[model samples]
Target chain A: MKTPVYFDYAATAPVDPRVVEAMLGLLGPDGDFGNPSAVHAYGRKAAALVEEAREEIAALLGVAASGIVFTSGATESDNLAIKGAARAAARRGRHVITEKTAHKAVLDACRALEREGFEVSYLVPDRGGRISAAQLEASLRPDTILVSLLHANNETGVLQDIPALAAAVRRHGALFHLDAAQSAGKVELPLEQVDLLALSAHKFCGPKGAGLLYVRPGVRLEPLLHGGGHERGRRAGTLATHQIRGMALAFRLAVESMAEESSRLAGFSSRLIEGLCALPGVLLNGHREARLPNIVNVSVEGVDGEALQLALRDIACSSGAACNSASGEPSYVLRALGRDDALAGASLRFSMGRWTRVEEVDYLLERFGSELTRLRRIAGAA
Target chain B: MDELHDPARYSPRVLELFDRPARLGPPPGANREGQAENRARGSWLRMYLQVEAERVVAAGFHARGCPHTIAAAELACEALTGSDASELAEYRAEFLEAALPLPPEKLDVRLLIEDAVRAAAHGRR
Candidate 1:
């Protein structure tokens, strides 16, 4: 059987062949496979490669190589940034602020802090899925030590105004942390304004299990792991050199192609939105103009979202419905936007990526139209 | 992962039935009809049964749910068409559970189908 057409880039992207080639060079016996911490010739060779990879990743964010701390992925980076920063600044303040629509990594990290006598204020977003800088200013307290927010929402693709929010956080004398897992390679980031940022390689066609957190010089963070003095003692583990090389290559490639790729993706998104909105009761879920180019989330009327997903089996996409989840609840991100359970359950997220072509988009539009018509008929809506 | 080991995602039977559902919609001249829904999960099933001399002559179902639920609903309709009307209650959760080998998390699907079948059977009685 043919593979389903992949449109779930927001979930995870396929590893680019160029990235894979770079990684394979560092993995075999003939490659730089020695531990960076060792003192042998092989170790020196491996250590140099790791440093070069660090610089490549840092160049994309316009940050210093020394400030980068490698981790397993965005979740780990998020945990290190939020929990580590909050704990290190506990004496200064125990209050932390974050948006309601942040990824689970950020929200759960804040929640864990809340359990440790830290007060957390979750700022609710406007209906357009944006948390205004004014909202952040209002939520900020003298005791607020950190404010964590996502640069782009994974589910809705809504882009936040990080520069404005960072300025506000700075004015209030608190650290600003950005979860840029979804936007790192896809959009331009204001690195100088953000004190801390988390990025995952897989979001932009790199390997999984390799990510980094950018901690500005002089930013204090309590180390989450303690052992060998790796990642400047912030995170401790032998680095996966192959994965790191792949991530850096992918990040660099993404940066190189971002401008052209973004415009092309925006066109695809517009076509998708136009075609989907033609169906009755279909509503766009996020800010029409402020969201990222690759993602389009919409809630359809008069059809069960899960059934529609199944009907569009040829299109590999995701639904906001919690049918696949153990809790069987609708998407919390959708619910945060004031959508009811039914509407939230009916939402679908279509995220296109580098490999997506116009023909595939056209096919998806036709397939989706037919499936929605069939489902609506079964539900007696048409 | 291989399809044989990952029972949680999709089974061949479920995928086959979902791709081309059998006994969908109310059959013509059906006397008994019942509907069941799990509002939280957005699963709905409606069953139609035609009974003659205390035996089910025909059965059909219309469903708007996940692939597992749709397949289960279709399977229930197909299974009950030749079954006795009095034996409807016997087609409980375990019966469908064994047939579909559905993931444990999807037991609610079985309940929805069972509810529809029981309702249609009661209406016939």
Candidate 2:
């Protein structure tokens, strides 16, 4: 069977071999099978493994080890960060601020918060999936206590100016939580002023079952899962030793190799951009030059994004809109850019990853160009 | 490791299953009937097929998705021939198991094929 090229890395990445190797020691009966809470030698060994993993993950983000709390993955980390922070600081303020296009985890958490009677100011991002810092500053109300913005958009790969946004959020003394699921290992973020940050290991080539929430000093969160007071009463469960160890290894490898990896993915992503741009009536979506190095979103007029995706099944790219392929509904991110639904619906997001290569990009460029040309003609596009 | 997104060990059948894509819209002449067939690509919905057929022959698909999707639909139609709607409903991964593997992301293409089958069942000429 021919191996298909994978371009949807933002959804989740394959675990790195380094991570898989690191996890092996924790899996077998002879490994660290002792429950972390058991004070015996075995338990102590397990506890040490968990703590060491914590330190490694924290160090990757430049945060104190104590601030890192491991969870099942990014979704849980996001839930814990947003919902926990909202509850922990609820008395200080009842209003929370966040932007649209946040991963569903953040948006859903905010929605849940609203259900619990907290008022949330949903910031509509500017075109390119950016929520303006000035708009955020203006949206601040005295009652607002937490501001959560995604560090990088999952769909568009648009990187938010976290430090600038964080600096503004600080003025109101509102706690800031950045959902760094897309950025933590892919790019460096300013840790200062980011009260809490969430990351999932899978986004950075780690195991899917492990993730961490960075709660800066003095920032506290109510536990999401209740048990034997694991994670200092924040998240409760027997630690997932293998997954946690794998995540730590993944983070270390990603942090150490981020520069070269970023450069490689940038080249790959631009290759897609250049290739897609060569198609007539093609449009590039997202903030030009302001997005993550690996993401290239574009729209070919008269070609349905999903249809194009279907045509080029040999290359596993993505369409931003979930609706029908023939009928055009613009991408929500593109719509935020004031593009009518047609342009938005026509948008496609192609993200490059560590495994991406020039050969794969070449195949993708060839397949995509032909697919668009064929789909246009088949769809009767004049 | 199969523990992750390992496409490495994917068998020919598994690869074909993941890669073979069905169409998203019904065939060109399908909508004239009471049923409007919508293919989701992985799972198919054939509602309102209130009768049984002795001999069935149909030509379909207005390619709405991609080459793989169109090919998958064509493959589905060919496979479903000489079979009844009930037989069509039970069509499993074999067609694709014989074809190219479907990607995890494009798995919906399979459902679209099923939808085409149902559309063909109640499908109007």
Candidate 3:
């Protein structure tokens, strides 16, 4: 058995070999390394590649090619979607709505708006990390012009009922922004009513420095960056042809294989959950049936979270969101779901991906059980 | 030493002690035990001492904490094993802290260890 195994796919996935192959074509001197903004022949060639890739990504999402605005990645896309839309509609309203379990990108973007005097409502989710449509509808007011929420919770893989939530926002005439960073290319998205959606390329095995935000036609959003009017004046940096092509190709590949891949990963997820929950005092974190099949998060009662994290160094799993790991704080997402700090901090999130095998899952389970027992004994809990 | 060392986060010495804390669990015929908790970090340390003739003959511990806290307790047990029982009254984690260099964030674990030693001393009297 490999000493160190990887199970933290939700943090970031290994770049697909196909994406790497396609990206190489546009990077070297012999490649199409032309400035996409240039009016010259090389520029035209690069621009054509970018547009084709855009069309492919857009087709995968079932949206118009013109709606996609390529950005650095999901962080930028989310910032652009939330702040850009909020600032553009400031005259219409100063209120925005989001959930407690949103990604920091969405939450922080809302925070920035709050500093600018925008009133932001952070709706707490149900104990299962779910934000109901009625909860959202009750919070929406005449002045609430934007509602930003993620389609799936990154920490626990708990999926929100986006269609129902989006309908509530629509009824209030507020623009809905979906942070589909975890769901896109992995699940079939019902996004016909979503006005703005954020996508991270790396989440779907694409390049890291690439992502896009879909801006529905007729929705006004102020540009985040200012320069030569790239991305139709929505995002202004010079286009990265290679990254864009890689992202597009990666999305296409994921969507093409999603059906079989989802089923395979769901099976792995089920087996892992069963093995883990069978242990005494181990509690599953998310809604059992309403979560993404790739991520399995559970809390081990009476186990030292930090010690458990240290012992499981052989398995590349997370105690919480990778972004917040350095802070040494209990996951705010779990706390929002009413888990005490002890249980919240003790939680482990194991996410599987395309390359994960059943053997690897079994190895993780075996290692987890032994480690739990050892740590419990050390703590005098066993 | 296992592959658990994140050099930026933990010292090799800390990992060594955490992995194989030989002094862990109650020493044979321990008559007094004291526990301390750092609720903020959700960590705790319990220290047990076997005292005879007003001298600590054996010491052991059980802990639930980060590597640094557990390692500090392990080192604490070693330091307590041969000391006069009264020394626990004014025991400080300064020696343990010096032996195992820690980052600024984990400095509180020292206080927890000190509190456990004091608690053990209080229980003995």
Instruction: Report DockQ per prediction, comma-separated.
Output: 0.42, 0.11, 0.61
lDDT by residue (A1-382, candidate 3, tens digit) is 5657888889899899988998998899999989988999999999999999999888888999999999999899999999999999999999999988899999999999999999999999999889989899999999999999988889999998987888899899999999989988778876797999998999889999999999999999999899999999899988999999999999999999999999999999999999999999899998999998799999988877778888788898888522236565789999999999888888899998988989999999999999888888778775
lDDT (Cα, tens digit) per residue for candidate 2, span A58-171: 776777898888899889998998899899888888899988677778988999999999999889887777877799999998989899888888877888887678878888
Residue A60 miss distance in model 2 (angstroms): 2.6
Best by DockQ: 3
Over A259-281, each residue of candidate 1 has an lDDT whose tens digit, in order, gives 99999999999999999898788
- For this target, which candidate reaches the highest TM-score against the unseen true structure? 3
Quote the TM-score that chain A achieves in each candidate: 0.98, 0.95, 0.98
True contacts kept of each: 0.56, 0.17, 0.67
Instruction: List the candidate numbers ranked by lDDT, top first.
Output: 3, 1, 2
| Model 3 alpha-carbon drift over 4 Å, by segment | A321-328, B1-5
Interface RMSD of predicted model 3? 2.3
lDDT (C-alpha, whole model) for all candidates:
0.87, 0.72, 0.88
Docking class of 1: acceptable
Give the top-scoring candidate (lDDT): 3
